[model samples]
Target: MRYVVGITMDKRGRDAVSLALTLAQSTLTSHPVELDLVHVIRGVPPEQAVSKPEREFQKLCLEEAQQWMAKTHDLIPKTIHSTTSVHFSDSMATGLIDKATERPCDLIVVGAASHGPLRRFTVGSVANALLHSSPVSVALAPSGYLPPSRLTRLTCALGMRPGAEVALNVATQSSVLHDVPLRLISLIAFDARSGAAETTDAASDHAKKLLVRASQSVDNATEVMVDVAHGRSIESAIDTLTWDEGEIVLIGSNRLARRQSIFLGTTANKMLRSLPVPMVVVPRFPAPESTADDDISI
Candidate 1:
């Protein structure tokens, strides 16, 4: 039920915002829920800030947030509710994550500020900061992105540490809520340092046990499939497969740390950079007291 999105309060943020709500609606369509849209204004540097212009910009940003919230309420069907916020911070993504953690949303949606799908490189991987620090799932909407009229399924990136249980729980909820099928995949993992002994029958047997338990936990009535691809690296294996249209990928964040900041490590950063499709990075577990709507988590 908790969902958050980080947006830069600038001139170009309007479209990114529109896409954010629309993405939230599209994802939560079947379930019918509200979203908490957090906007952080990282004020201009002192040298760049003129008293009048800075004041004017702040005023305008507040006005836009007010109008945007009104527009969201007006445009989105009445079933869903929205709580809009505008705050000041020096760091956009990090500050938003702090607010989101306190509020404790199930997922986070971010709008891409960079490239297109056609480019050879990652057209937009700007959500890396949020993916690393967030205590919940993060969703990255593409630039000029539009949600499909109907959401068929959500794809998740499986990792070893996060385990399969949490991601499946959120996915199943979305599946049941939106009336869509669920696709569960265990991206075939290849450990470079893995020994030939580990790949033997015992390991496969143990893995089978985990996957079986994983499937049983989710109340997924949708079609499900397991894939095992062969590749030396994660990227190589990932590139070998094709991403389905309208698919929303779910990922999990690292465990909570004492210090808070945006951006993740190299592996996660690479994943975000290489994959052009939308991704949702979930926080590993519940967070500290300060980050939620009702101040519920202590």
Candidate 2:
């Protein structure tokens, strides 16, 4: 599988690159994996139009991108073959999507956006746009996150819906490939409009059945565990659960949306707001057919 790490001349971007490298090394042991480090240079304003200052600014951006590439190259292990590229475009999100489409990468890694007074790692503009439009899966690295020494577990946020099986399959495959344990988790939010006790009981029962069926499909080498979180909201429910380091959460796209479209449901979006660890958004199976030109250049 080919993985592209979107980098910028900043700390968050470097963290994203490092996390991507860690994932590549851990999961691609059996297959050939190629890592591409990319930096997108937003096009200077046309209003500036050929002015000396505009020209100098463009040159400075290119120089900084190159320097970042060099620093990334030094951080990579010699065993992992990699390449670095720069894209010049008007939109950072579009440029990255184009680059991923051109490489046909299976996954794209980026850093969570830091904003607001607290500077919490929220889903930034680029990631938010990609979540809906990207042709492939996207992974978000939290602010100041360092790659774990190893991938200890993959937790699937099973929704007990039609498309949720896609996420289960991904989590199962990752566990088998990386030889890590697999966990199936379902969250049941307490709805005030409904009978809370009955709803919770039904949801818990459904989650247990889903996990049983899911566990049967996995290989013997992979260990499977199950849990269900229940509370007033998705966030509150998730907070009640215990999480360890070296764990990643996998979420499936919406089932009713267009095929292969990355549709983040309400639960998935809520989970992203306070994701404790890295999160991997899994698209639907049988990726949508693309007639659009793939040879996009920045």
* Tens-digit lDDT string for candidate 1 (201-275): 444454455556545745355555445433566577678777755666665454343232223445555566566
Against the reference, the lDDT scores of all candidates come to: 0.54, 0.75
Please, what is the TM-score per model? 0.70, 0.88
**Per-residue lDDT of candidate 2, residues 1-298 (tens digit):** 6778888777768768767876777864566567888888898643454888888888887888888788887888887878898888877778888887884577888888755112135877888888887767788887777778988888889876687776776677677776778888888886678688887777778778877766776747778988878888999998898876788888888775567667777888998876688888867753433213321100
Separately for all candidates shown, the number of backbone clashes (residues 3 or more apart, or on different chains) is: 18, 0
Best-fitting candidate, scored by lDDT: 2
Q: How many Å off is the CA of 96 in candidate 1? A: 2.1
What C-alpha RMSD separates each model from the true structure? 5.5, 4.6
Error of 2 at 197 (Å): 3.1
Best by TM-score: 2
lDDT of 1: 0.54
